[model samples]
Target: MSSATRRPNTNCIHSGTRIDPAVGGVNTPIHMSSAYLQPNPQAPETCYPRYMNIPTQQAPADKIAALEHGEAGLVLATGLAAITIPILAMMRPGAHAVFQADLYGGTHHFILAEMERLGLAYTLVPETDPEAIAAAVRPGTTLVHLESPTNPTLKIIDLAATARAVKETNPDAVLCIDNTFATPMNQNPLDLGFDVVMHSGTKYLSGHSDLNCGAVVTSAARMKAIRETAVNIGTSLAPFDSYLLERSMKTLAVRMERHNANALAVAEYLERHPKIGAVHYPGLPSHPGHAAAARQMRGFGGMVSFELGDSPEAARAAVQRLSVIASAISLGGVESTITFPAETSHYKMTREERLAIGVTDTLARLSVGIEDVADLLEDLEGALAAL
Candidate 1:
């Protein structure tokens, strides 16, 4: 049967596996040899790890493609590399691109810092609205990049509408989405007309924080270009890391279910709490993007951002008092993590720039884990009480 007919959970487990005929093993074996002996010079060569696309690495790439409903995919060494590879591949000298201003800080920094050096021009749209994005597209625009349930501020964009608008403006322009905040279990941007979907597999895809990997899913033709670009940049995921990513994806569906439940519970609790000045979660009806998110997503996702009623100092104190959640950077693991965007992720941005994007000093970002709802709530409440 075709992968399209299989359920997500089934696809997660079997999408990429190629049983070894020699041992009849169900799992794909890791081919650790960097070099393979070639018997024929005329035939296409599969004589090197980077050039061959070995089974272990290909397995997870196939699984990610299946999950995102894309034609093909490439796994990379890191999420940042995943983002950079695609953008670099699609852009060239004098090419123009449009991007959301509230993008993940790293991406924002990359574009701002490298555009001139790369000989590309770009426009940063201040809002996630499709019309605003379309308006920013110039005649030279070659790409349109978007993020939904935006970082540190859960702003959801209308993917279909935006894709339509971008394509209308420049039919050949590529539309890319950073799908890290909303895992494939929660949202599938490719189905909504996006040309490319990127993920920080270090997050929910791995479930455990032990692996560092990134993924890009797109049409077969686009995948070919991306794979070539990745190989040249030396960003291809290692065979061992790919094996781990494949194993972790087997439980993606179950883990995301728990993440959804735990995050919704946490968001609701914070919304009702007296000390929270504001709560930004698509699951919350009061959130500006709730309706759009409901229309496009299966779940509202695990991330939640909220502000302390008092000040940035109070937010820092609350995070310091937390016992269950770790005070650290990076997110989307089995363990909950909290970080102040002003101090970590978006610290590089000026105060004015951060405020322009609604990332206030008091805002705290949360990657709610699969922990028990009661325990998570108690931990958060205790922290708030201390504030």
Candidate 2:
């Protein structure tokens, strides 16, 4: 059967596998050669690692593009590079962009600190409402950026509504979404009219936290532009790292299933705990964005954020007391990890800036792993008791 007709789980395992023509090997071999031998002087440029369209890199890129339902993809060295390069390519001098207020701290800093230097104008919308986004657009607006189940806050934006509003307001604008939290297993922004979808392959895509990689999925034309920028900036993924990412894609569907079940279980437990304040998980009925999430996503993702009722100090103490979950900065690994976003991910922002986006000092974000749900509950309960 064609890849388009196969189930997602089937696609995860077999989407981009290419048999070795020479040895008939089941796995695609990593071509570590820096340069391919030129057949003749008149031939086109030969394959090189930095070009990143070689077999090894293209294998994983192909899988990700299939998962996102895009025509093409490019792999980068890091998540920030994946996001930044695309912005640089799409928004030229004198261009304007509309961005969500609550964004990954690194992305927020880059836009506010660098856009002016690049001669680009931007506005951050405090709310994700379609009308608010429509109001922020300018005649020169070239990009509309969004993050659903937003970092640490789990705020779900209405993608279809936002895309419609932005496109109607500015026909030339391109809608880009950061699909790190939801993953292609749970959501595909392209299906909802988004122009591009990006992922931090370091997190869920690798699923083991051993590799750092990023990917952008979009039309062939957009990818060609981004690839040109990536080549000029020297931000291509390494050959070995691309091989690892390809191996990880084989289990993405199964891993995400476990992550979804584990996260929902943990969210329910936290919601009932007396020490917890608000649990920001779209799977929960209490979440403000639950209904919209249900409509757009196949499953609520593995990420959950919550607040302690006491103080920031109490929140830190609980993190220290946890026995099973590690106190870590990143997320989406097979091992459960938690972090105080106010101190880590959002630390660069001022206290007022963090709170303005709902990342309070007392809030903690958890990246649920594919572990036993009972053990996770016991570990969390022990930490809360310590607080």
Candidate 3:
């Protein structure tokens, strides 16, 4: 059976598997060429790395594309580039954008700083209800952007409802989501009605903190414009990084199993502790969006957020006490890490702005890794005890 038609776990290993013709190598060999020979000079199409047509780049792109059930995909130098290129391509003069306020700080800051400069008007929707999203859509809005299990907050956006609302309100508007946190193993936004799915491959998709990469998956029709923009902007990922990303995905299915299990166990432990004020993880029934997440997501993601206390000092002290989990900025690696959002991801936002979006000074965002649940729980317990 073809990999695409097979189950997702199988697709991870074989969807883009094209054996080396030079030898019977099991893995796709890295084609370290910037140029490829064209049979006809006037043929108009030629294999090029920047064009995202070469085998090395296409292999990983195809794997993620199939995983998300998208018709096409592209990898970029950074997650910002992957997301920025598509939003810019889809927007023409006089077109606007609607962005959910709870976002990765970089994306949120980009909208606030760059949209108007680029001549695109935007609306920031503060709420998650699909009705609110539909209500915010203007006739000229060309893009609607959101992230599920939102950064540092663990808020779940209703993917299907939000997509339906966006399309029904403005069919021309492209509904794009940052699927970085959930990863394809937990959720496929395309299957839930989203038009485009974006990922910071630096996170779960790469499953390691060693590289920086980004990916976009969407229908073939919409990707044409994004591809053109990306080529012009020179953001295509290198062959070696693409190869590594493809290899990382081979282990995604197995790694995420442990991530999901360990995360749930950790979140439950945190929820019961006297020091944890509020635990935000969809796996817990107490989470506000638990019902929607249960309906839409196959597994509650490995990320968890909680309130440490009223002061930022307490949050800082707790992280300093951690021995096993690193207090780091980036997430989704095999090693468990924690971040104080007030000092890291959401640091750019003013105190009032952070509070407005439910990001308190005490909020700690935990990227649960594939560690033994007992060790992870103990690590977190040691950290929280310092509070």
- Each candidate's number of clashing pairs is 0, 0, 0
Candidate 3 C-alpha lDDT tens digits along 242-291: 99999999999999989999999988998999877999999999999999
Worst 10 residues of 1 by lDDT: 43-52
Q: Which ten residues in a row have the lowest lDDT in candidate 2?
A: 10-19
Write the number of the candidate with greater TM-score, choosing between 1 and 2: 2
- What's each prediction's TM-score? 0.97, 0.98, 0.97
For all candidates in order, the CA lDDT equals: 0.89, 0.90, 0.89
lDDT (tens digit, per residue) of candidate 2 on 259-353? 99999999999999987898999999999899999999998999999997588777888889988999998999999999999888888899888
Q: Global lDDT for candidate 2?
A: 0.90
| Tens-place lDDT digits, model 1, residues 1-387 | 778999999999999887899899888898898877767867785655675288888899999999999999888888888898899998988788999999899898899888767768899999888989999987888889888989989899999899998888888889999999999999999999999999889988997889889999999988888888888878878888988999999999999999999999999999999878889999999998899999999999899999875877777888888899999888999999998898888988889999999999888899999989899999998889977
Candidate 2: residue 383 lDDT (0-100): 84
TM-score for candidate 1, residues paired by index: 0.97
For every candidate, C-alpha RMSD to the true structure in Å: 1.2, 1.0, 1.3
How should the candidates be ordered by TM-score, best one leading? 2, 1, 3
